[model samples]
Target: MHVLFLAPEVWPFKRVGGLAEVAYDLPRALAALGHKVGVVTPKPRLSQEMEQGLERLDTVLEVPVSWKRHLAEVYRHQEPSGVEVYLIGHEHLFDREGLYGNAYGDYEDNAERFIFYSRACLELARTMDWRVDVFHANDWTTGLVPVYLRTLYAGDPCLKDAASLMTVHNLGNQGQFWHYDMPLTGLGWEYFVPEALEFYGQINFLKGGLVFADMISTVSHTYAQEILTPELGRGMEGVLMARRDRLAAVVNGIDYQVWNPADDYRLAANYDRHDPSPKARCRQELMGHYGLEDGGGRPLVAVVGRLEDRKGLDLITAGMERFFEVGLNLVVMGYGEDHYHVALGELAARHPGRLGLTIGFDIDLAHRIMAGVDMLLVPSRYEPCGIHQMQALRYGVVPVVRDTGGLADTVVDQRPGVEGTGFKFEPFTMEAMLQTLDRAKQAYDRPQEWRGLMQRAMAQDFSWQAVAPRYEEIYRKALELAGQRQRA
Candidate 1:
């Protein structure tokens, strides 16, 4: 099958979050399965070193947005994994310092920018004579791809028959813009009704995708169910529930090649599940780098990823004193929310050698932390699908994650006689998190049990190779639905 993926961010080119990583890895995984996979993303302002690799195409795509015609230049690059990447370049709209927005917040013209990009994706496919079987749209950024496919490009011979599958990475970001911006979509006001594009008094891009696309998917099975409820739905529950039959969940996968501890050059010393003694060297290096001292063999636990309230950073802050009293050393990485920065910094100062904090993301440091940390903390309030837990498991590092979404699906809670990989807490409370931490520490204190747990985690496989076939199955089902729609 020929699948063309449309996403706002693709790693190595532009990456703001997990969506970027998925865009890069999933297509490569699909290509490896002997299917033709192509990715279309907006070309942002990149470093000169990165830009040299792109081959600018002569074709100028005439994209219609609202009443005006916008011309877009295309750049092509063939990835090492044989996946073809096409970057739609629009200097005024996309050539910015940030992919979505700068430090101020989201770009004011975000709806307009993505509207142009979505239309350009179809134009690129048609111009290149690439017959796309499935136009897999990711998140609200490319949500209109499906809407445009069934509307504006419905009669176009090249793209008319292509099926669309819209994957919602997070329901919280629905791309709700002012109702007046409906004109920017170049669709009639009829689409602005409650049953279609309109949400409350705004134009909702994601809602349109849910209504128009043949099939919809999210990151994990549990999350697929979660979004149908009011709590996690973020006000899209009714639309999602109406199309519940069309919705499915496939847990996100990690690239084992990039995450394998035995082969990771970023680690202080390489080790696998079989011989994890080298992890001690990595642990020492990580501590030395952070100015943290080994606390008489206390288990070292680390929190990685964005430090926001949604990630249960509040729980971490609330339980910090108790966690330290219980003989646990803590290290934090990744940056988010200024309040967390100040709070965690103050805590680190108070605890001196016991607490270590790094305010931003560094890929090299991430690898070292994963390899060295005895336990990885992922107590999210609600996680769609977490990649960190999977990455930690691959490195023989046990995860202590909240029992929700993909974390619940991936991490098996350790119990007596259960061949569990890690620890889990159900309630989203600091007390629950602390209790789970105590259980993990108790297990860590028992060297034999801790080694068993680590080995069990490392043996688990959440690789893209194992996950790609499921996507293929969904694409086939989506094609079936498309055929039914065409017949009607």
Candidate 2:
């Protein structure tokens, strides 16, 4: 099968979050399975310098916007694994310093920008010599592709039978704009109704895809179920419920080649499940790197990612006193809201050598933490699918996560009778989080049980090798659905 992955960003080229990583890993996995896979992403400003091995292609894409023709230069990057990435270049819209927006806020022109990219994706498919079997779009950025295929380019033979699948990484971030922007879609006003792109009084790009795509999927089965309810759906539960049969939930997988502890160059010492010697060295190195004290026998717990409300970071802040009282050393990495920055910094200062805080993202440090830390903290209020917990498990670092979304699906609570991967807690509150941590700490004291838990976690397979076949099945379902729709 020939597949085209349409996303706003691609990993190692333009990345803002886990979506880019998913955009990078999944296609490569599919290609490795003997499928013809290509990724289409907006050309980032740093592409020329960052994309070392890619060569420019002769293909030029001219996409029709509402009234004008938008021209984009096409460049192709062929991975050694046979996956080809086609970058759409438009200086004004894409070649900015940021993938989506700057520090101030999201770019004001995001609606127009992605609209053009979505339209250009379809046009690029029409112009290319190879016909695509599936046009797989990610998040709200590429939402319009399914809409364009069903409406704007409905009669075009090249894509008339091609299936579209919209994978919602986060329903919280639906691309919504004022109703005035609806005219820019080039879709008829009939599509502006409540059942289509319209959400409340606004034009929602994500709704367009949800209504038009042959199928829809979320990163995890739990998330797919969560989005059908009032609390987690972000106002689209009814729409999702209407098309329940077409929705799927497949857990996102990690790129083992990059994340494997046995081969990771970023770590101080390379160790696998067999040899546990280097893991101790890694822990020592992590302590030295953070300027924290060693030989104290305190369990090292690391929190990596955005420190914000949604991440349930406040629960950590609320339990900081208990964290120290229990003789736990905490290392925090990643930047977010200003208040969290100030709060965490103050806590670090108060705790001195016991707490280590890094305000920004460091890929190397992240890998080191996963390798060295005793536990990883992911207390998200609602996580669609977290990549860090998966990476943590890969390195044999037990994840202590709130039982929600992918965390609920992946992490099994370790008990006296049942050997599990990590620790999990329900009820998104400080009390529950602290109690779970206490349980984990109690388990930490039992070396025999702890080792067994680590072994189980490391033995677990979260790689795309196990996940891609499920995606292939969904792709086939999408094709059948598309064919049925066309026939009707």
lDDT of each: 0.92, 0.89
Q: What lDDT tens digits, residue by residue, belong to model 1 across residues 17-130?
A: 788889989999999999999999999999999899999999999998899899999999999999999999999999998887887989999999999999999999999988
In candidate 1, what residue range of length 10 has the lowest lDDT sum?
12-21
Worst 10 residues of 2 by lDDT: 47-56
**Residue-by-residue lDDT tens digits, candidate 2, 301-415:** 9999988888988999889989888778999998878889999999999988788999988788889888889999999999999999999999989999999999999999987
TM-score of model 2 relative to the true fold? 0.97
Q: Which lDDT value does model 1 have at 434?
A: 89
What lDDT score goes with residue 179 in model 1?
92
Backbone clash count, each prediction separately: 0, 0
TM values, all candidates: 0.98, 0.97
Q: What is the lDDT of residue 251 in candidate 2?
A: 98
Q: What's the alpha carbon RMSD for model 1?
A: 1.2
Compute the lDDT of residue 397 as modeled in candidate 2: 94
Point out where model 2 deviates above 4 Å.
none
Report the Cα RMSD per candidate: 1.2, 1.4
The candidate that wins on lDDT is 1
